[model samples]
Target: MSTLTTANPAYKLELTSSPHIHSRWSTKQAMWMVVYALIPAVIAAIVFFGFYQLIIISMSVCVCVLTESAIKYFRGREISIMDGSGIITGLLLGLILPPNFSLFGTALGSVVAIALGKEIFGGLGFNIFNPALVGRAFLQATYPVPMTTWSEPSYAVDSVSSATPLSAMKFDAVFAGKTEMLLGNIGGSLGETSSLAILIGGIFLIAIQVVNWRIPVAMTLSVIVFGGIFWLIDPAVYPDPIFHILSGGFLMGALFMATDWVTSPLNSKGMWIYGTAISLVIVIIRLFGGLPEGVMYAILFMNGFVPLINKYSVPRIFGEAK
Candidate 1:
């Protein structure tokens, strides 16, 4: 009998369907890819919000990793932060936050995200709500004033931060101009300031095939459809669809947060429904609700219903009756 050695001529390499799925594009890869996609936004934050943004992001990530590690350690379970889910959650929570937010608040948000959003429902892929959005919502509810407070950067004389365009529009409709909203020159959350930067990151994600384009597309369309209706009713009061799409957290939330594979729906039809529903909730809240911005809450809220959407929207197999 011939031995199966490298030198033996009988050696055969068995090829399988999933053979190439070794370690190149795994869960770890996905986590790292998300981080990679956010680098541009991080750079944008640093430019627009200053270096303290980096500090906030770092501290938030550190807290999340430590919080999760400690939970596993005290419970006599294995270290789980290595999976990088904590890292992704940290970045997402950090990026959505305002630049000057206190370190303690960021840490609290991280804890809420990892503990309530992730660990309670089982870590990583098993979670129902998007962890980062959970943190965002918690912070928004607990610290309504500070969370909404925004400061514009000064290229001119010394100036203080001001409310963002969307926030302003939420209160009064007269401030929605063409240039201010388009260029993202207003003050807002660290990541939501720059629609240009967010769109760049979105393009990279779509290029890598890491995110499903369907969700963003559907979400954008839904926003336009809903916003357009209001604009038609009162063009003077309601901002145009372009301003609606660019201002606030719509692009940032739809492209980066809402498209999270683990939390969002799985099927193509489900993605459209998920995106559309979220967009509707966001528009409704921003238009009539108390909160100036509602993208984060809308996403987390709809994330709760994703399983049901996936359960029903799944296309039946061919020749198989439902």
Candidate 2:
């Protein structure tokens, strides 16, 4: 038998396991990049809401970090708070909450986000649902009245009882102008109100290749196509597709929540399926369901199917026998 060796005695082929391909990208680096991307939304939230909203964001982040540290310490794991995942979870949860949501409530949600949403599932890479959305859902279910309470932009005066665009449309038969929705002058969640801010952050993430472009594109196209169908059928009854894109949590969830590295599918085809299904559910719920918004529910619902999607959607190896 011929022995495999290099011409140079020191040079020899090394045997390694799979994943022969590697990138310089680290989980810490990616997590911090996501933090940077969320800055615009944070700034926008401060502008649209009041300076007090900063307290909510700060408290949430602190709580999340502390909760994660505690859990990791109890489990005898190395502290990983500096990795930035906890901050991202806190920031996302704060952004989705109603303006001026109680600090205690925000803290409670933060603990659940870290303890139940993440650590309970074996931490960061193993989480099945976006931790932030989990926190939001918990808040929504536990405190429906406070969670649904909306506030007008800080600039608005003499506006009584601010209602989200979706809620206004669904309950009062009132439609907010597209300009108001686009500019985020209308009432909604802290970060979700400003489609402009979200687009700025989301596009930056895609540009840096930190976020997969397929998920957001698939979601946007799906919403446009499905939502457009209903609008075309009865323009007078349904708001235009642009309205759906600009209002509620669709943009935020599609770009940030649904695109979570752990919870989302592993392949391009699976991404399309995941994004489309979430959008379809959102349209159905927004148009016909009791709740005015469904982005959180839709994304979480699809997250459960990501494993199956990945299992079946895996690409065939080149030249492999079929």
Candidate 3:
């Protein structure tokens, strides 16, 4: 009989490894904090794109959670839908997607992100790739027609024939120096356009200690420094380094994707090199390579080399064997 008693209850519950796991910090709480951190971006999306932003975000999250749950059930594993990882992945994916994307495609993206991006790599912390980017890349590769056709923040379906600013830069040289590119009035994926929103959220995460400050600082500095020299030499070709720093998806990738704790280098020196290399790759891709927005690919490319970075770039410990 389970009865309430002041002195002694009818039974004493046994506890295990996770008994005291949640001490003021929970995965759910942490995820919600991430959601809270995303509030500014959500507001920006809604203010620009209207209430449809909410619909897209909701669909992204719902599909991700449902897919995750279905996987757990089919695999005969404990339910983990409440942990909020699926929610995070969905939100990140939605933010990166073109706002005018098909709902079916969005759902498929969530499923792919979970099943291939995460679970197949042994789930969450063990994944070799960023699940969100994996889904984005998959869609980009498979459906270049819809995936590349970006639209400005518009409520009309007929007006969805815009190209992303990065694509524009890659294709149209005449439209390179426009303010719309930096201020996010241009066509692109929802979150990638607004460097302001990404910066605000990144700062919040850093202030709250939810994210480290190293990666963003190093990467941004590298891009600006490298791009600055070139821009100073020829403004006709290179936009302001500030524009390069603030435009497209650099902040979003540096702050969110490159800073993934599991995939990024653990030590300080390795972190600096990791972030710098990513930034250099981003610049190379944007300037010398084919891609206009290189953040996602740069992070994915470097994530493949994290283990090697960890091994070689690790600073010698105090009084350690040489």
In lDDT terms, which candidate is top?
2
Model 1 scores a C-alpha lDDT of: 0.80
Candidate number that wins on lDDT, 1 or 2:
2
Give, for candidate 3, the lowest lDDT window spanning 10 residues.
1-10
Give the count of colliding residue pairs in each prediction.
2, 0, 0
Q: For candidate 2, list the clashing residue pairs, or say none.
A: none
**Global lDDT scores for all candidate models:** 0.80, 0.88, 0.74
Tens-digit lDDT string for candidate 1 (39-108)? 8778877877788889999988999999888877786767766667789889889989986898989999
lDDT of 3 by residue, 112-177 (tens): 988998878766567888888888888888777788766666643443226665565566643444
Q: What does candidate 1 score in Cα RMSD to the true structure?
A: 6.6
What ranking emerges by TM-score with the best candidate at the front?
2, 1, 3
TM-score of 2: 0.92
Q: Write one digit per residue (lDDT tens) for candidate 2, span 1-322.
A: 0121112445566553432334344667878888999999999899989898899999999999999999999998878888888999999999999998999999999999889899999887778999999998999999999999887888666442499999988998778887777777878999999898999999988888778899999999999999999999998889888889999998899889999887998778999999999999999999999999999999999999998998899889999999
Candidate with the larger TM-score of 1 and 2: 2
Off by over 4 Å in 1: 1-24, 155-161, 177-183
TM-score against native, each model: 0.88, 0.92, 0.85
Q: The CA-based lDDT of model 3 is what?
A: 0.74
